[model samples]
Target chain A: MEIELNDSKHTRNSWMERFETYLPEVVYGSIDGIVTTFAVVAGAAGAELQINIILILGMANLFADGLSMSIGSYLSNKSERDNYQKHLHIEEWEIENMPDDERKEIEMIYRQKGFEGKELEMVVNRITSNKKVWLDTMMKDELGLSEQKKSPLKAGLSTLVAFITAGAIPLAAYILAYAGKYQIDPFILSSLVTVFAFILIGYIKTYVTQIGLLRSILETLLLGAAAAMAAYFLGDYLEKLLV
Target chain B: MEIELNDSKHTRNSWMERFETYLPEVVYGSIDGIVTTFAVVAGAAGAELQINIILILGMANLFADGLSMSIGSYLSNKSERDNYQKHLHIEEWEIENMPDDERKEIEMIYRQKGFEGKELEMVVNRITSNKKVWLDTMMKDELGLSEQKKSPLKAGLSTLVAFITAGAIPLAAYILAYAGKYQIDPFILSSLVTVFAFILIGYIKTYVTQIGLLRSILETLLLGAAAAMAAYFLGDYLEKLLV
Candidate 1:
């Protein structure tokens, strides 16, 4: 038999939908990047370390960490997708081998939801008649699984790109300072830049999660500040002990 | 009327249940602590700064950041609880004043669930008879919210304790070195210590989240290493530019 191809036109609107799918990963990756990288800079500054050493360590951390995060994201997503497929297969097998048992499960599920008598039987009959519908219902109601179907590669790529882009923010001040154009302490500038990055990330997070914008921004700022404060004081105390 | 002393004997079993509830916060706090503090140590070492300076900054960071994290956790949790309570009040008000409309919503909700005829009417009747049950069904089915009565104070306390306890692991070597007891480079020792901490945290995370132990451990290791590497290199690069 000849196969009929059912293709739909891809448009800018579709691409935007895909972008929305990746938004969570982007937001999380960016937040992780800026916070961790800035913590490094703050630590170095607290130690009164030379600018050169800070640059080496910070740069190493930025690229290396960003790549590693992306790889980890890729693996995690891949594994989740694998697990989902495995379950899907198992569900399909059950439906094929034990039709009666599977149909009863649907009946019981509806019965528990207050369905009874003719209505309950009808729901079971209607759902079990369609293989696809039966499978979907079993997957959701019985196994509590939902199909996400996000591409692992795209997830990883988004994380990597967002990481590098956001991770560079704090370091920008230091880089500029080292270029002989700015006379101020690079650490001071780094702090200012990082705070701004934190606020921006928090603002973006609000858009994605629909949290109150001001609350999100303040929360991010507080969290970053807390991390830096702990690092700084700890370093100071240890220095005193050595002295 | 005599008041019933609705009291049960307090037992260790109840406390264990409470402990289980705080497990997620502990895991996250510990992870945050070790990673952020270690980032500081790595940054300081990269800059070739005085060991004393590193210790000072690191210790300062440990305490300050831990407290800050705890406070932030408290506020975030409180806000969530407040929002939930506010919505709950609104739901209660609607149910009281708009009983007819609300009952229709309940009926529609069940009908959509495939309940029909006698079963659909029973489901609606049973639900509408009890105010508390009706409120709960509306909250969950219509509002899509479930009550999560996790205490804000407990969450904050858990985060603070975990932050200090786990965060201290990486700094143990530095503290020992500062005491003039360890001859080896403290940074090297700290790296080893922090890696162990990362693995330990990952292992605990598995127990909490039911993720594969090996995968979790590896992910944690890579993430921590990536952060340190980026911090170290960036610090180095900036140093050269300044020179």
Candidate 2:
């Protein structure tokens, strides 16, 4: 397909989209992070947690979750770069040892694209004459790949930042709620924050894909609500049986 | 960067890569679907379930999760396309209203890449004379957007299919483990399947991002494991307090 062009406004700014695309991973990770933390805190509080225990779980998840996301992002990106390099190595070897076969492949590819007879032959010759052109054709036509690439460290770090930021929501809620100098309403405070975060996660989807921000928010709210409800009801059942 | 022929295998058949990418999603989703389904079943089973209630929850998660994932995928894709069109509209407006601003943009973009005064001016003029060229310049230089976007529906449908297929794992496991006559160790079976699914999820990362197979599998495994473990333990604790 050919390229497209239009407005400069869309080009000049994009802090919104950046935040949105990062939303899925950040929000997905965070919800899991916050919910997990809340369950731990709620249990500790139920089992009679000293503030210290709550603080401990909070700190551990903050570091461990963030660290894990960072590492996951880093390692995943590294692997992509490595895969690209492996392909490059194979191309290099093919050019050195099997030029004729590689050239024939190019000719066939061009022919398939509607070029025919002498024209096809000419196009293939022009490309295969240069090693770089030959390899480019192979990557595009055969691998059906393109030039987009990413930095592993940047990925690891962005996710880490996202994790920490989202994670702080529940911790802050917990501390402000029950662990304060004056004990606050734990259930109300934690549930509200969690619900809000869940909604935000959904709304953020609008910015990312821009289908319907309203819909995205609703969907996320549903998922979050569902998970929490499922857990809550099941908890009641378990409590009846075990506790 | 201009597309380069950097590898010979880029021309090889890519059906394998495409197929492999979805496998993990199917496996991971299936296994996690199963484990979580197992939990649902076990919880119901624990609740004095008429063996039938256990069956009902498992079937519901199996179908419901699959349905939700499918709908989520479809909407997200549709949303993305809508967003793209919205931006495209904005850009189209800019091109018609401010030709000079757009022209200068082309020059400014090339200038940053070491082109100077006269040379850059010549390049800009040559491109702007053709409406298509002008738009292409604006796209590449100003917006950095692409027209070769995928069909969101295709993406959504794939997720739906993959999730449905994956959801079978735990549902099947539980049905066999405690629901009916089975010789399987329930926890062991569910845990093993979950881990295996995670490994597959990790591997699929390579499919989307050109990341390495091993690294993707490892990262995905860790993330998936972390999410589930958090859920299981916290779920364990919450059952004691909230219910």
Candidate 3:
């Protein structure tokens, strides 16, 4: 797709624009959802488990694990933000209390960046003269932190929604088969459904990251297939061991 | 742990120092490894698959999926690095061919940071006077990209090693049980092993990121448990549906 860099002013902000920052959470959640859920369905099929058992386990996993992932994402993001803020405050205080030392730090940072002599002094003076600029520079250069003000709640919600949405694909086949919609083995149907889901997620990932389209799609598809294959074979072997 | 910022001079470069950048890849690989492998085992058990099948599927997932994930990580990182380099080269060309425009961009960037009047002009001139500085400023300020010079091969290797290490935990019980060492249900043994592994990984994650230890450990454990529970129940449901 054509991504116009300066289109923000010309075009109305779409949903993707509004929630662009949360795209990572969504992609991470969806990939996890598809891989884990499909592994469950594939393993059960390999073991020849009863249909009710598969549905029970799948549905339980879908919501429970999805929620768990979202909460984890939220907590991780919150903690990171808190850590950044804590450091930012510390930097601000240091700049206030030790202006000379902070100025030296700015000099050191610029010097390391290859500045020297009159130029380095000018750069340092220009930056330290402004409190905000000095603080931001210290936060970034010294502490290696970014101003990622992502909302934890929004991240959690995005993860949950994406997790459940992508996760339901594998189980959909079974649900349909149970409803007598298809004659084929539910495992086969689930594979087809999941492959499609993988490709769709891959495309979305490409859109968000603006990476290579074919490679991203293939990478995701291969990842899902690899997971399912491994689960299936392992389940089959375990069945033989018990017997 | 006490992390001394200037300790790089006092301390000799350690293995960790050499490979610190690959920590994220390791964490990502480990988490994916444990969750996916355990899901396979849990689903197979719920389906009433034999111990042999669980081992087979779990091992397959451990190796196959782990490798897949590592390769994916490698390729993605490589592509990202390439993209950054491509942009860096373009920025260099722009700075050389169209110096005026590039200098203005530098001014605009600093201006957005609230610099104005003499300070803004000085900042712009200071940066543009040096080719290297100008390019670096344009890359970071205008493009919002940082120099992430992480080796893709090291990232892949770290991911593969961590994946196998963490992924092996869930399968340990089945391997022991198959050897007739344990009389308890392998699932129960596996759960205990995995919970410990989860906590350990959580602690590692906490160490790497310097987040809350208790919260991180609890989060990882809960995530693993939730995924297992879901896979178990889904397998159970599917079995019944088929019958």
Candidate 2 has an lDDT of 0.55
> lDDT by residue for model 3 over A78-176, one digit each (tens)?
878878877887888888898888899888877766678886887787788777778877776676566666888899899999989998989998888
lDDT of 1 by residue, A126-157 (tens): 66776776776676556655564689899999
Better model by DockQ: candidate 1 vs candidate 2: 1
Candidate 3 stretches with Cα past 4 Å from truth are: A1-15, A42-65, A232-243, B1-14, B36-68, B113-119, B228-243
- Cα misplacement distance, residue A170 of candidate 2 (Å): 10
Q: What DockQ does each listed candidate score?
A: 0.24, 0.10, 0.31
Candidate 2 lDDT, A45-92, residue by residue in tens: 433434543444444435544555466556655666776667777876
Summed backbone clashes in each candidate are 62, 19, 48
Compute the lDDT of residue B142 as modeled in candidate 1: 66
The predicted structure with the larger lDDT, 1 or 3, is 3
| Candidate 1 Cα deviation (angstroms), residue B193 | 4.0
Q: How well docked is model 3, in DockQ terms?
A: 0.31
State the lDDT of candidate 1 residue by residue for B31-133, as single tens digits.
Answer: 7678767776776676665666666656665676577667766766776676667677887899899999889888876665556787678668866776766
In order, the Cα lDDT scores of the candidates are: 0.72, 0.55, 0.75
Candidate 1: true interface contacts recovered? 0.34
